[model samples]
Target chain A: MAREPGGEKIVNPNPMMSNGNNCQRLFRLLLGLLLAVLAAGLGYVLSSLPSPAPGLSKPVAEHLEASGVSNPVTAVLLNYRAYDTLLELGVLLLAPLGVWSLGVAARHREPLVDPVLDMLARLLVPMLILVAGYLLWAGAHAPGGAFQAGSVLAAAGVLLLLSGWWPGPAFSGLPLRVSLTAGPGVFLVAGVALMFAGGRMLEYPPPFAGALILLIEAAATWSIGITLAALFAGGRPVAGPHR
Target chain B: MSLLQPVFDIVLGLALLWLAWRAVASPDLFRGIVLFIAFGLVMALVWVRLDAPDIALAEAAIGGGLTGALLLATLARLESGGGAGTGRGKDRESEPNDE
Candidate 1:
């Protein structure tokens, strides 16, 4: 850095650094151009393809009655492609477990004792819980489901934690573990049960599909709620001193 | 009224693009996160316009709300850890206290 005659500070660029910067700029420009061309080519090819006469939605709707759910989306999720739903639940459970594997954080029990937050939690948590339950129940007919309900439930838990009413380790225990795995466990059991009952794996008998889906959803909601809450907690909870 | 719908769509689309660009380009991490949360919110509106209320709800709740909260908390933790110990910046002392 040096002051020029005009009293302006100037820093000389190193030759090697300038060369590296130029290389990066060239690479970025080439990458952008290649991606743009690829995108345009793909778009052209896709647009040229003829549209299907009968879309998949029609068939999905036709078979929806047999899936035991009124909502076509729910029918598709809980019945038509239950394997995917099972895997998604497994992934949700994996998140908390993965966090736990990182080892516990130093336990500093600092309860945020703000009056406003406490009051807000008191007013909102119970109402949010009700909304979550409603969303779960409405999934059979409406645009809500285990995932949405579970997210709301997790939000309530987070609210409580923020207000300092709920301890960090409140969710840590054998019972919590069981609840965390309940969704995928129940889903697996249902699959195995169907296999034993003369149906293919995950192929719920038509008469019983509705009940099975509801049961699986209930379990999944619980597990998802716990999993999301644990993820926000950011570390494994050890057994509390009280425990 | 039909013209209004198209106008709204154009405006929303432009807003979404602008918010996304700013979110990705912001130099400050905190500002970037706040912009990202706003982008999620606008994206939820896009989902609503596309007639996917379920996705809109999920995006707003999870993407905008919970994810924003988690990111903010993580930022606070990081700042508190690095700021308090290293005394890197003059603003370090006041940062954790704000939380």
Candidate 2:
């Protein structure tokens, strides 16, 4: 508050930044207190909650043997809720397609000449590929899965790109499109083929479920890897002579 | 030893809160983004502590790693386009008003 020449009291227009940082400090203190109170309330409520029952765990486990995967998470993801997985793959495919639709040909980024980066890429890329393969294979009985493995593959691709070892144009055109769409395409065909066999859409016969799931996971992993790398590249890779 | 777990949990909770606050309130955009990435990593650790390994893996990979890379890449692109220091200074001034 201040007194004007007219003898009237007036409030300051800018409370913060005019008081030599004190006002801003006070404001932050108040905000922090408010947030702390809210967090405490939430924590208190959550602490009183009872343990949740296994709503779908029993059913999922009961049918796990028939789902053809030893891991319940894999069975749930690739078998019971296969439609959701298919749609997720569709979303992955759509992202790169949208990026490509912008039609900005990627400007050639100068490849890094740093020895350290080159050595790191050389060492890590092969290891990443091996781990991705192992993850995909182990998803049947472990926490590893296509998404995690695909992300590792994508990381390897990003590393290669950053090191300038793999140029963006090398992955353009028909092969790119095939790899991008292979997941959803394979999934769709599998689902339709099931219909011919008197099984519902996306329902694999118990005997063949494991093999079909492995195929779908492989395709999805490859597609996801390509999609993520292409998104990182930021433009539609133009078809070059190498392609 | 059993009591140590809750103590660890409390410490983790406070660290998470501090990281989140710093990430959101930092004036420097690049610093804020880096803080956000760190927050994601800590959150992944929390997921691990909660016994959700799958979620922990995804969060670390996508949320921390990929997102940080994407944000840095975007910052570089913007800087290259509009000149340096645009991320920290003149963010509001340089951005076009879409509305």
> Over the stretch A7-62, how does candidate 2's per-residue lDDT look in tens digits?
12224457464583566568778997999999999999889877794489999989
lDDT of 1 by residue, A167-222 (tens): 44565688789989999999999999999999999998889999999999999988
Misplaced by over 4 Å in model 1 are A1-16, A49-54, A105-109, A168-170, B82-99
| Weakest 10 consecutive residues of candidate 1 chain A by summed lDDT | A1-10
Candidate 1 lDDT for residue A5: 22
Which ten residues in a row are the worst by lDDT in model 2 chain B?
A: B82-91
- lDDT of residue B7 for candidate 1: 96
Per residue, candidate 1 scores C-alpha lDDT tens digits across B11-86 of 9999998888777666556887898899999999999999988888788879887888778766766665531112
Top-DockQ candidate index? 2
lDDT per model vs. reference: 0.79, 0.80
**CAPRI grade, predicted model 2:** acceptable
Clash pairs detected, candidate 2: none
Clashes of each: 0, 0
lDDT of model 2 at position A175: 84
